[model samples]
Target: MTGRHAQHGLTLLELLVAFAIMAMSVGMIYRIMGGNARNAGELETRQRAVVLAQSLLALRDTVPEGGLQLSGESGGYRWSIHSALYDTGVAGPSVTPLHELAIVIAWDDGGRRRSLELTTLRPQRKPSPQVRK
Candidate 1:
């Protein structure tokens, strides 16, 4: 080789291998980011459900004896609350004096249906303080 001769920077095969590695790295990063985003969305839905459940529980005294249904929208999410009687005890088929409340929060994310639910037991009659007889 002469002293002034030029040198090739990179062979075609080497260049192709480098491009493939870069592409794979980018794809992996994208997948991780996408999964993280999905998880974050799910957490938000769950938190909203918890808040709704707490609010409904706070209003337990307002719930009727038989059944209750509430539907509304908040923070770009639609929610529903269903209250009904639940019996687990087996004693002459008797119902408990408390009510079971279920709150569900739903939202559309990336053309997918996402939802969260929270269930709780609430007293039918709120306790009142009274002086002893």
Candidate 2:
């Protein structure tokens, strides 16, 4: 038993190495977590933009014959709605005209311009004929 002594604990060099490795691992974990948090925030912003776009599209039935062209800002986002006549290449007196409606939502994210567009087709409304008094 007196021939050799057992090593009871790590040396100073070994302890330093272990600390360095732990620091590196913690740094990597923090970086990953930060990225995930940023992604979640961006997703939330995009979802809000989609909701706003949908609400704007729901007003399609109220569009006038001359076509709707409106723009405004809401919740730090700028939005625009446009309508145009969509040609089906078919000509007839009884054919109902189709209108192409588009809504665009734009915002500035981290100094970058981001935008989303939603488009839909709707039938144009015709006025009713008046009867003689």
Candidate 3:
């Protein structure tokens, strides 16, 4: 072609390469967005588990001095609470008896088992003295 009639457009090969690059870029972006969405869901589930476990632990005062074991399900999640005497390793009678309270939250996520556990120490309440007649 003469210089005066020179083409001002991309060749077929260039267009094909550009389209390929664009396709790959779009695929990568789609994958990133999908992964972000999945992570957000997993995080939400974990946050809910933590909140449930905290709520169960808040009932520590009601636990018996001999310790209590309970389990139940709520909102598609299975939960359990286990309480036992917490030995501080201090010899002799302590001023306040401590108990270890633990809560486990479990659920099914995308065919996988997910669980969270939280533990705390609480003092046992003493029994009231008998009233004199």
Candidate 4:
């Protein structure tokens, strides 16, 4: 081979190494993009779960305080509401009324069930007075 031609072109070994490096770089880029897309989807699911939990919890005021369990679905999520009278471990005062409310939101993620829960205590509503004729 001519000296000029040999010097002007990359050696076979060097070209192979260059191609290997480029392949590795492309693989890394593809993996990073795939991971980013998966993370975005997971984040979206988590955020929507939080919203569903919040909405279910907000219904505490309207829920029957005698202990109720309700189930429903919305926004690609399923939710359940559970309520029970909160006990302080002591005898009730008979006047103070309180309820413990729990809201659970669940969804299907990659064939797995993902869920979030929100819980709080709320005061019991007063009964309406009787009307006279």
Q: If both were scored by TM-score, which would come out higher, candidate 2 or candidate 3?
A: 3
lDDT tens digits, residue span 1-133, model 4: 6556436778999999999999999999999999999999999999989977876676566445467788999988998888889876656557557788888889999999999888888777766778989
Which stretches of model 3 miss by more than 4 angstroms?
1-7, 91-94
Q: Any idea what lDDT model 4 has?
A: 0.83
Q: Which ten residues in a row have the lowest lDDT in candidate 2?
A: 56-65
* Range of the 10 consecutive residues with the lowest summed lDDT in candidate 4: 56-65
Considering every candidate listed, which one attains the maximal lDDT?
2
For this target, which candidate reaches the highest TM-score against the unseen true structure?
A: 3
Q: Per-residue lDDT for 1-133 in model 1, tens only?
A: 7679676699899999999999999999999999999899878767776786577667665456657788888877787889877665644424346578888878887788878787887645534569799
TM-score of each: 0.59, 0.82, 0.86, 0.75
Q: Write the per-residue lDDT of candidate 2 for residues 61-102, one digit (tens) a residue.
A: 755678888999999999999899999998798987888989
TM-score of 3: 0.86
- Ten-residue region with minimum lDDT total, candidate 3: 88-97
Candidate 1, residue 47: Cα displacement in angstroms equals 2.6
Candidate achieving higher lDDT, 1 or 4: 4
Residue 2 Cα positional deviation in candidate 3, in Å, after optimal superposition = 9.0
What local lDDT does model 2 show for residue 67? Answer: 80
